[model samples]
Target chain A: MSSRVRKIRENAYVMNTIGIAVFIALWWLAVEARLISPLFVASPLAVVQVLFTQTASLAQNTYITLVTLVESFLVAAAIGILAGAVTGAFDVADWVISPILDLLRSVPNVAWVPLAIIWFGIGIESQIFVSAFSAFFPIFTNTYVGFKSVRPSFIRAGYNLGASDRDVFFRIRLPASLGQVFPGLKLGIQNGMAGLIAIEFLDSTSGLGFMMGEASDFFKANIVIMDMLMIGLLGFALTMTLVLAEKRFLGWQRRTS
Target chain B: MAQGNSVLEVKNLTHVYTDSRSHVETEVIDNVSLSFQEGKFVCVLGPSGCGKTTMLNIIAGFIRPTSGSVVFEGKEVKSPSPERAMVFQDYALFPWLTVSGNIQFGLMMKNTPAKVREAKVTEYLEMMGMKGFEHKYPFELSGGMKQRVGLARALAVEPKMLLLDEPFGSLDAQTRRTMQRELFRIMAQAKKTSIFVTHSIDEALFLSDRLIVMSARPTRVLIDIELKSAKPRQRSDKEYSEVYEKVDKVITAEVSKSIE
Candidate 1:
């Protein structure tokens, strides 16, 4: 088992190296041919220089963006999961709340920026609200579906074993539904981050999106490219961390499936 | 028939399911009456779609009958209780839980204390010959192993009765035979009143003290044969063949009639 794991790790490293090398080669060729104007898309070398030159400020901006994104995601996830679980478990709750959730989800996150600014003002709160709104729907829908779709046999088994309604929900239904909802949660967080960045680009005065907007306005294409790279890198890192956490926490689920 | 020792009594039970789209009321079980004696192994045998499973569900109180009642130990069953546990054909072991966890689930539901629940789980695990597989999840185990876990889970509760819905129907022939033997040994030891539903003729004859044969859809009891064999019944005995032939003839006729 150890040897197999080691081989898999080595293969992953090699694949990453091959991917980066190919990407760098393509970037170099594009720059040499001037296929992408320097005004719009800076050269790889220029972007790297900008990365070092603005490292401190860039890191600070990235930190701000990360904090806001994480806060929004955690809040949305907590609310969505709790509401979805309650609604899914109770028929009256589902009847009362599902339509309202659907209405909220219908309005796009970017469209909420104007109202969010009026309500929470142009700050982290507004951005967080936008992110939370963006994330809420998928997680809610997935969790509701997951809870509702649990097999009748399982519920019956629990009941026959003398489980109370509450016991059934907590012990059997919640854990079973997690198998379906976790993927949705991951997707919701990713989309929420994207939505946060979009809102920031349109309205915010700080964070990675604001940094990129400022660089674009000044025609500092390299700095703009660096910010975009930072966004991608951060998103990738966060998603990987979540996936790792899922694998660790849900090892029993993996073993079962 | 044993007198005044009935563990389960189903009287004139009927169940009708109404389709939402078609607005058609289909009667699954029609005016069925049966009584199971305490500590007896009774097998309900019938063809597919004969509502054998519906009968089991009604007895388990998983579904309400459209008419009549299922009385358990002189009390009418309104809802599922731990006194009656079911071992489903699919082995319905919670996919998220390990084998030990599944077995302990019933004890937990009954609010059995931690130490007692652990002891019961351990005992049943050993009885099921699944001692080392307690930590393995349902998906990691074979179909036979999963069934054993289901059986252990059911047994751990020490219910007054057990309901088995074709427990070995999904297994291969060899595994099915092995499981059947194992089931017999477990039932003999526990002496729990059991209602087993199966379509297999030999299986019913081999395992049951009394076999109730039913007609296909809109099912009703066609024949109830009492096997008077002593303990450790010999499959090749003349009396066993006689009982088998009697049930086989009745079921074959009923099946053909239903098809026509």
Candidate 2:
């Protein structure tokens, strides 16, 4: 609200506007000159026209993609965080899970799409499984680190203040780990979005990924470009929503970096 | 087992830590015996790594000595119990809790009724001179303020004993002196038996009813003395200087011995 801050913010917006305009102008010029094939890459104007023409179906598919992304992420976050904490707390559990986790995490979750499809068939279950699979590793690892890396002094203080082990876990351990956990959750959501798109493109009869794939198959370059932009914007908006919520809830955290 | 005579008694306490890989054992505290009288202020002063904090940790039941017993009243100390509360050097004020909540944490652990918890929190908040900042989180406060909340939290539980591990070590000199005065005031008001660990001779001299000095590891008691004091003890006064000089020389000799 201060004049100085407002002036700097306005200057930043002006610079961003110039950068975006330059990119669009170059893209438009490339299409106009036919340096890139019009049969593949669409012009910005054509993409806008396609967005307007297919507004109803585009909105419907976007909604479906958004829901699948959220539901899968919620499931992954709940299960991953709980399991991560348990494994982190007990050395025996950590040792038991370590070798399998090492093998599984190295292989990208999107590569599990074939396995998911075979197990769940062509239903929404496949999309959810694929999305949750993509999300689980990052969230689990981060949550485990959060539990493991809690300062010994904090735990000692908890015990000195008469907290039971159960109380310490619920109160200190969980909140102390929350700083790292939020970043993991954000990364997990992004990975979840990637998996949702992959499964939807390959198997789902509906959603933005299917729309983009269908458009590409028909060689509707404008529709493909519009769908791509919508997906990018959806990912951006959802991630920013999480960032804002993190700020609101974890306002007390003083980041070292 | 004379419960009325001493609030805490540690009998021939010894601790040895074995390095995991090297299989070498280092004795931290060597055959030390001491007792804390009821409602007395006790200071344990030593060099940086001289196991004074370890001694306090043992008394507070965070650690069990490898070969001896620590009795609180008549009960043997096995684990950290509500009867002994600690204030750490780093303050250790919970980051997520507001000032009021941190102070109430002990009472919450005790499962005190909501009404009493609220009243007790307000009482300690005012006692620590932290009235209006009850809702402010730890990150919002300055170092001295955070330690005040830490003190408030420790004392709120009304523990039979208080353990302070260099509680003012992080503060600037002026703030440290101010906290020392505040600590004296709080201790006088509460009348809890306190075990304070510090390296500063003046801090040990000014605050203690009994001061115990320790040598470097394997640590052993170097000097134990009781003081006669009329507090608001002026630091610049002749008697204060005399005691300070004596304590300083004793601790400095130990520090030099450690280096040699």
Candidate 3:
């Protein structure tokens, strides 16, 4: 059984490689056969060529975008988790805040972008505000659900074993909630990334999104595609990092029914 | 050792559970009165969902009785205390904690000195036959192993009594049998008062010195009998079979009534 599982895991990576290879081969063929206009869609070779030629600018913009995303996401996560824990732990707080939260969350995060820009003046603050706003709802909602969903048996055991209300909250409820919190953090980061790009299109002088906007205006399809791929790679890397962290922290959850 | 001294007493205890949405109140325990003797392994046998768990929870102080009281060592039991550590059927060992960490939890809650906590953790680990599994998480252990850790954690607190809510119910038959023997051995050594609740008459027969058979809801004590058969009693023997038949008749009647 162990050997078969190991074989399947090894084959998974191989399959992923083959799948990507097939996709790129089809794209290359399409470009080579003039199936699309180069002005609209850059060939894979052209995108790669731009990667080499604009390495310095691309790297700097990528760094800026990454920094903005991380900082704003951290802000959202800290407040969201605190708020979630509080509301989840207390019945009165849940009753008072739940409806208000529902009202605020119903407004699409994208709808906040123009107001954020107006309030914070097209600066980094505007980018942070929009990104943090977008990220907060998922983190808060999921964290609340995480805390609420803790098994009643655990709480009973905690109380029976002499845990005070405070001890049960921190030791039992908070730690148990972590398994659900990670997925929220993953969604938060993705939402923050989207918000960062949207704000960057209107505000930032330095970011992959701004670079893409600038390149597209100049009809540099290759640079535009290259920027999109860089953003995609960054998002994928961030998500993978969260996945590894979740595994590290919630290792006991593995193979759980 | 069933000493004449009582460790705890329930005085006309009754509990009614109310559904929040429906506002319907169900009287689960109806004027039940019982007492646990010092250092005796007592088991409460009843039909399934006969409020056996409710009675256990009240005794554990996890829930308040609608009327009457539970007194432990002359003090009224108002809320959960370390004095009565409970072992849940689900083996609610903190999944995040290692075996040693779980065993050490109650002691840590009491603010025991670090050295004392470490020593108690080590002692319980050895007692539960989980010495090498100290660093293993609950998920890494089998159903039986998890309950052993649960038992160890409860015992490490040095509570006045152990309240087990069908601790071995979820284990497979083979594992459950092994655990019953292990528990018998541990209780002999630890000598703490215990109140074990189970639907299985066989389990109660195999474990308890004093057996309390409860009826279906609204539940009351049907009979409280002393099993004078010696420890490690042979189930095939005439004495064991006789007691089993007596208890089986009471339980089977109750089960059918509940089904009807």
Candidate 4:
């Protein structure tokens, strides 16, 4: 490697730390200088202090949100992939079902929150329904397009190699479509988190979104900021998990590219 | 060379492709008739988009010709069957399957016993010179190696005939030469009836026992001649040049005719 490139690579982590430290120092300076109102923004110190003080509440609320997120995401993935495979594989089904899905997907997912609340009440059931509804569209659309986009030559090869129609579908089409499905699932998870937080803000008595809202009402800026940071952390962890899973399953794709 | 009985017969095949959206009809194949004897290698050379692939697909039973029939061993070919395996230009090996799995796919589909499938896969792996690469996926291999696996996957099925559609069209010149030599060696040993379609005159000359040159779109056989040249024929040889000149003249004239 060139000296410049080697120097950058070696100091990459140190540079990241320095950058973060500088950002935090600037924020502290802004608080101390009173350029920002104390009522609006929390000082870096105060947010960290709240992190230790409110650990129990943060843990409990995060656990609740995490559970709802997983449950709703699983539900979305199962139905989305199944429906997508069916609709994609059969022309008649695609013709009949895609228009309906398009219409349903057009109505903003939050629009269903009211109906969900009425159906399942202000609880985990309602939360999951709303979140899963939001998550479903991306996963379904990606999987459908994935299946639809299978190379004709591959299908012909499958049949030419003595495979039955069903064999060709299960063996060739399903696995080939998975490369596209991973991106959809990633987007689905991000959207699911959005829906979960939205529903929690509106109706839930538990979860991080509810806790953040309650803190905001009481003017606990530090607690609210800490909760926001926690949400960011959770989203990062979940996305990392998905990326790792994708690597494990689609190793062939990575090697090729 | 003691060629066997007629294995595949194409009688007056014509195909018209219709675009459902634009409602435009394209007559791709124009009443072409041909036949293949058992254990003979036939190579088809044609202008680009002259419906060579359409003819191959029709013979492979992947598509029905608009008119006429394709009969193989006295049976009408209505749909794709394992008996006629094809090697594609793109090397259409399953991306998800390892090399071994790809070669064994046909056996698995046939519901051959596990032991037999394993044996067949191993046999083909050796034959294709891909012995140690069984665990590797298609994407991990070079283009030449991928086509080797593709050939293994096709030949493992013990098909009655092999159909290759520009199998080396995508390869580098050096790799194409290597693959062509490998293919010739393997086919000679197996002595299976084979039909190959390509755009290269030299490739057709180098590989085929019989050669068919096709006309432009709405394609028909312009010439079909048995190559009486000896095996491993050199391009520089007097006989090779004589036949090459004859075939090259026909192709050049047809290409200019299309331009006009």
Candidate 5:
């Protein structure tokens, strides 16, 4: 059984590699045939070359974007999770705040860009605010659901076992909720990154999003393609990191139902 | 039956579940009085949806009785206390916690020192024959194993009274019988006051010293039979069968009348 699982994993990796190669080959063919203008579409090789030559500048831009993304997301996750957990723990808090959060969640994260610019101006702060706003709803909603969905029987069992209300929250509700909350956080982080990129593209003077916008304006198709790919890869890397962290933190959860 | 050495007294207990629309009220448990003595296992038997669980919940202080009092050891029961630990039908083991972790949770809640909690967890895990599976999660465990953890968790608290709501109802027949025997052994050793709720006639006869048969919703105690069986009862014995038949007839009659 173990060997079979290992073989399946290896086959999946090979298939993914082949898929990426085919996509690049098709893109290269399209560009070579001049079916599209060079100003509009760049060959994969040209994009890779651009990425290699401008490695230092790209890396610097990526670092700045990454820092801003992390700062904003962490702040939002901390506050949103804490608030959601608190509201979920207390009935009155849930009754008062859940409706307001639901209303806020309905408004698109991009819709906040103008307001964020107005509040924090066209800088890193505005971009961070936009990212934080985008990330907050998913984390809050998932956490609230997690907290509220705890089985009553568990609570009763805990109480009967001599647990205090505080004990019930910390030991039972919080742990139970994490099973739901982590997935929400993973989604929130990805959404927050996307929001950050959008804000940067619209108004920033630095970072990968800004670089993509500037390249598009100059019709530097290779640079634009390279920057876009970098953005996607970065997002993938961040998401994978979060997933790994979740697995480690929730090892006990994986064992139970 | 021995009387007047009551460890827990429930007087005129009543519980009502309110309808959301139209403000209608339906009583789950009607005015009922009962007393349980220490060092004896008491079973409350009734048909399904007969408020047997509701009565247990009232005593456990999970739900308030609309118009009565549950006095435990001469004090009025206002809320859930550590003195009354419960075992649930579904096991209700914390899915996120390991076997040892679940067993230790009650002690941790009482701010028991880490060393004492660790020892107690190890002791209970061993007692339940779950020594090596301490780190296993609930999903990895069989239904019987999960129930054992639930039992161990309740026992670890050393509560004055143990409340069991059909603790073995969800297990297989063989497992249920084994669990019943194990529970009897544990109860014999601990000698804590206990109240068990179940629909099984055989189960009630085997574990309980006194069986309180209840009528359907807005429930009331119909027959309180005192069994003379020795501890660790032999289910195949004539005396056990006779008691089972008697209790079965009483419950069947009560259920039929309630349906009518």
Candidate 6:
């Protein structure tokens, strides 16, 4: 809250606006100068016009993609939390299962696209599986670390207070691990989104990714550009909502920043 | 089995462990044996890294001594139980819980009636001098206040004894002084048999009825002296300085030897 810090932050916002304005100005100039064909990269004005005019279709596709991303992410998160807690709570469990998880997580999720398509027949199940696969790692790894690194004193305190094994996990372990868990969930969301878009691009689909793929095939650069812009906006909005929800749940945690 | 008025006893306790990384064996606690009666404040003083914490943890039943036993109320201590509660140096107040919630935690775990829990929490809140701030989170409180809450939480459970590990070690000198005074007053009110561990000789002299001093790693009792001083004992008193210098001299020598 120092005056200097406040001034610097205000200038940062000003610079961000300037950066956007400059990029758009350059884009318009490039199109006007005919330096590149608009068929490949549409002008900002054309993309915005398309974005506004195709609002209904855009909303429908966006909703479909959003639902698939969210459902998969939720399932992945639930499984990750349970499995992570098990690994974190018991060293034997970690030794037995962690290597397999690490091995599976190491592969690129997009590589599963062909298998998913073959197995689920280009249906929503394949999209969801891909999304879940992308989202699972961050949550799992972070939750495991979170459970492992919980201050020993808190666990001691719980037991000293006569908490049973069950009470320790549900009452002390889970709630205490949540601070570490939130960052993992946040990372998982971003990864799931990237995976969702990549998978959508792979085959027959109804979401924004499919629309973009179809448009690009016919060289509808304006529509493709608008769809890409919509994807970025959706990611931003989802993350912001997550950050707000994170604050509501984990605001009590001591934040270094 | 009833040792008359001997509420707790530590008999021939010894512990050894290897450094996980170094893989070299070391004895952290060497055949330590000591005990205290009910309602007496015992302060443990030792050289740095003297395994005072390890000993306290054993007595709390958080860890078992490699050999020997801690008997409380005629039973060998098997595990951590509500009968013995600890006040930790770092406060250890759950970050996600409010002041009242943290204080009432033991009671909730024990399945005390909500009505009784509410009453006991309120009582301890006032006892620890942290009234009217029940909803504040641990992050909101200062070091001294948070330690007070930690103490209140421990006391709220009505544990038979209290174990404190450097509870005021994190506070500034000024806050430490104030908390020491407050803690002394609160201990007087509860009159629970308590063992406090500290690096400060002055803290030991102020709070303890019996001072137990220990040496560095593989620690053994070097000096066990009864500090017969009345409550609210003056820091500048003749006897106070006498005991302080005696304990300080013994610990200082051990500290030098341990370094070598």
Point to the candidate with the largest TM-score. 4
Deviation from native of the Cα of residue B191 in model 6, angstroms? 0.4
Q: Could you tell me the lDDT of residue A70 within candidate 2?
A: 91
- Residue A107, model 4: Cα distance from true site in angstroms: 1.4
Assess every candidate by TM-score. Answer: 0.95, 0.95, 0.95, 0.96, 0.95, 0.95
Error of 3 at A240 (Å): 2.2
Model 3 is docked with a DockQ of 0.71
Best by lDDT: 4
DockQ of 5: 0.63
Tens digits of lDDT, candidate 2, A140-248: 9999999989888888889998899999999999999999889989999989988899988988799999999999899999998898898999989988998998998
Writing each residue's lDDT as its tens digit, candidate 5 over A103-123 gives 888888999999999999999
lDDT of each structure? 0.88, 0.89, 0.90, 0.91, 0.87, 0.89
The residue ranges of model 4 lying beyond 4 angstroms of the native Cα positions read A1-10, B1-4
* lDDT (Cα, tens digit) per residue for candidate 3, span B85-113: 99999999899998888999998889999
Give me the displacement of residue B258 in model 6, in angstroms.
Answer: 0.5
**lDDT tens string, model 4, B125-173?**
8888878898998878999999999999999999999999999999999
lDDT by residue for model 6 (A1-257), tens: 78999999999999999999999999999997899888778898899888678888889999998888889889989998889999998899999999999899879988988999899988799988888989999999889998888899999999988899998888888988888788888888888988888888877568988888888888999999888888888888878887898888887875544
Candidate 6's clash total is: 0
**How far is A33's C-alpha from truth in model 5 (Å)?**
2.3
Specify the CAPRI tier of model 1.
Answer: medium
Per-residue lDDT for A112-156 in model 4, tens only? 889999999999999999999888999999999999999999999
Question: For this target, which candidate reaches the highest DockQ against the unseen true structure?
Answer: 4
lDDT of 4 at B60: 91
- Candidate 4 collision pairs: none
Which residue runs of candidate 6 sit more than 4 Å off their true CA positions? A1-14, A52-57, A254-257, B1-4
